[model samples]
Target: MTTGVERLFDELGHFNRFQACLYFAAIFQAISCGIHYLASVFLVETPTFLCDGPSNITHVLYKNHSSSSLEEIWTHYKPGDGPVVVQTSKGDQWELSPCSKALRLNVINFQYDFFGNKTMESCGSFLYDHSEVEQSIVTDWDLVCEKEWLAKLTQPTFMLGVLIGALVFGDAADRIGRRPILMATSLCQFIFGVTAAFTENYYLFVVMRFLLAMVSSGYLVVVFVYVTEFTGIKVRTWTSMHVHAAFAVGIMVVALVGYLVRVWWIYQIILTLSTSPFLLYCWKFPETPFYLMAKGQYKEAQELLDTMAYFNSLPSTLKVSQLKDENDRALLKDTKKHLETEKRLSILDMFGSLKMAGRSATCWAIWFIGSLGYYVFSLGSVNLGGNQYINLFLAGAVEIPSYLIGCFAMDRVGRKKTCAPALLLAGVACILIIVLPQDNDLLAIFLSMTGKFAIAIAFGLIYLYTCELYPTIIRSLAVGSGSMMCRVGSVVAPFCVYLADIWIYLPQLIVGILAFIIGILTMLLPETLGEPLTSTLEEAEALGSKPYTKNAAVDRLEMKQSIKA
Candidate 1:
């Protein structure tokens, strides 16, 4: 009997196909970006702000807690007044504000013993449970808008989650299979997102946000890995570029929704919860063919290749035995001895031999700064000082044309030259925005638009460029590491916005300068537009074979040889 994979491969033949499969980023980012995390950032709590105060009492400690039954807890009489005196077991007396304005009017006081466990018992809000009471405290305050220092507290940490996720999740993807991780994250994302939406306690919300961000890490890296593996080399670059552009599209899409749905928390619920469908459906998509090959699931890989061949309307070749799943077993079984001999992969491997530490460092710096500046400008869509969604939509619109131009020019002029100037000029555009008067709306918009345009171009070029620079063996790892660097920029992006409130443009200027320096440094690298992908770092450096060095005479001569093969 034919196996399941073989049958699946037969059915896949009817689908549209290219030299390689193209899983557009538009499919991922547009769906994922709607999270309130991307849109309404205002709900994030600030922990530093002092809440227990005389005037602030009117704002409600918990909310709607009127208690006449606290008479037993009171010693210094207050039949109707808001303030009362309560006596402690140690014979000390203190004047305390009544729970009249608090949401939990029936709250019972509790004390802890030396080991720091709850020792004394108390009854709180007879009508409400502990969860409800905690919820009351959560919903009761607007710490940041109220100028509470605690509000500033949450902002710093919100970013830390993104950073930690970027690093930790890279390992997570490696240790666990992609399917399990992606599915687990999707379930957790939905749960945490819901918890975050309704959570009344500030700390609880913060915890959820961190969890949400942490799971988000592998999502980015995995999507690229998936798309890159499934696609043919001819269309891979353009498709990868589309994935990031999908993120931008997501930003714009969510910004518009955020504009319409002004209730920040409600918006968060919508963004996070809405994408559940996409993730659920994504579960059905096939695993990466290369990942299968590596795992030694050669049969699966063969079946997948047949599916692709069917999709492309090409005849399927090879027997079922030949189509083993490389991944389902040992990826480098033959090389295991060599790996054991070396015991480790070195950073020096990136240089191939000459120790191109300077070049590697410089490239990483460009990757980092390009990430930073790109975010500063792209996310600055929130700062457009008008309809945020409209500005975001318009900013996003600029990319379609810019990408089309890039897709057109990159293959023509080549990679490094085109990418470098785009980055450097993006920096200049950022600086221009600072000097341009905020009141000169037209010039400001123009300069800002130019900055965004450059960022989009630079961002697109980086993905394709990094992939080209690294050879196939370490291609995924190199790109993923560079992506991890982008998370550093992402973590800081929020803090920069916070600082913008104190000194507008200061952050942008810092970001711009960094981008310029790195962009110029990127020019130090070599170009590889038409060359066959080098399979190892050593081959990458040797740089044999000029690409497409076709003479009409040689092409005509090759036509005769083609008949012999």
Candidate 2:
């Protein structure tokens, strides 16, 4: 017998206007999420700044002068003896020092050459460069010097929210329904995101950002499943790939907005409010029939199917009479059994068998490593060898092609072949950066972008592959678990960038090594291309063992039946 999803597809028609509208509507959520997740790039970026210097120096000598004049005075009076100049083959560069002492400024003269010997004292406050950004959280709150670590915590805080949100909302969506949870979270995201833009205190800002992240995670996870269920299997991969491409567009949108708007709060306001329009139109989207069938709400499922058929300009093929009372009772019994089975299942079940345990462990590790590498490149773009705006845009822009390649590879070759090779290439590219001359920024950026591209491809493929690997009952839980690990990876990403303070290559080294090992682990996963989705835990377990044999006669009969339906 055909499954609920199959039946609906037959009636409503795949790639119809109804499904097209649903996919199009859901994609805005992806775009909004992309902008919100990375808004920290512009929100907390530290502009060029130095200590404000002693009040006596500013008020006494430079009180009447402009901010620039005051800054010049500070530079003159303060230590000209900061970093030591080391001559390199490319150019003169300041050698990084562990303990560059501050000299006290005891005397001042307009004619005095700043490089001349002077006593330097610790600066009491700071003056920031306001040319690019008028005010970011870093400048407004002075999140530098001793408070610098606090600025670093913002990215991780949002990630922690995502980690927690995955566990909470993933289970909730599976139990409550995708439509309700999706709507609830989208509203929450708008509320929290907009509130975050107006926050005056850093701690409150963090809290708001955390809430925003928590809600958006639900939107992201549920919407993917929602869209996938509505589309036919033949075109599902393309549809999923386009969702990610929309995310790339969102990334570019943020870059353009940041470039144009310069003020942090205003940028946040625009980005956060942009998603409101989608929320308004979200009511038109339909809940997945698969979800309704799983809950034993066959009547509602049939009505929805009829509605879809109407919208798609097809006949009302799914009538109430078609859902036989006996079949409905049997489905209810199956649903109850599945619910009870789910209650009994735990994380241990993923590892209940040696074979399944290995696969689960490998999938989790690959998710973590791939996500860690991906975020490291994305979050650390400001530190990359180019203009921050251009770097961020390119980082996102390159992903469009990477996602396209991933879609093609998964469709043609198989999940294992596509994911493993992409990850391996990412690892190799990262490691190759160490061999390139740091002075040659062109080559350095090229290699780094190559790594980013490879990682992006791996990320896109793995999400598709992971969903295919799990049974329906535990699908959300499995994907959520992987996303939990993914969030942990993102949490570590900022600190990875911080490692550059000690050694520039340290972060890349960590990401490269982990990716290589996980790439090998990824190869061990069973291939799932052209395979039907498994519905039971037992079926999922058998995937790694025997290859599925196709029955030509059965397929031909089903094809004829589908055509008639």
Among these predicted structures, which one has the highest TM-score? 2
Q: 152-235, model 2: which lDDT tens digit per residue?
A: 899888888877776688678888988888888888888998898888999999999998888887787777777777787557
What do the candidate models score in CA lDDT, each in turn?
Answer: 0.55, 0.72
- TM-score of every model versus the real structure: 0.69, 0.83
What are the root-mean-square deviations of the candidates from the true structure over C-alphas?
A: 12.1, 6.9
TM-score of 2: 0.83
Clashes of each: 35, 8
Measured on C-alpha atoms, candidate 1 has an lDDT of 0.55
TM-score of 1: 0.69
Expressed as tens digits, the lDDT of each residue in 109-215 for candidate 1 is: 42111122222222221211221112222235544333345555554565567668656755665566555666666677778777877877677877887777766
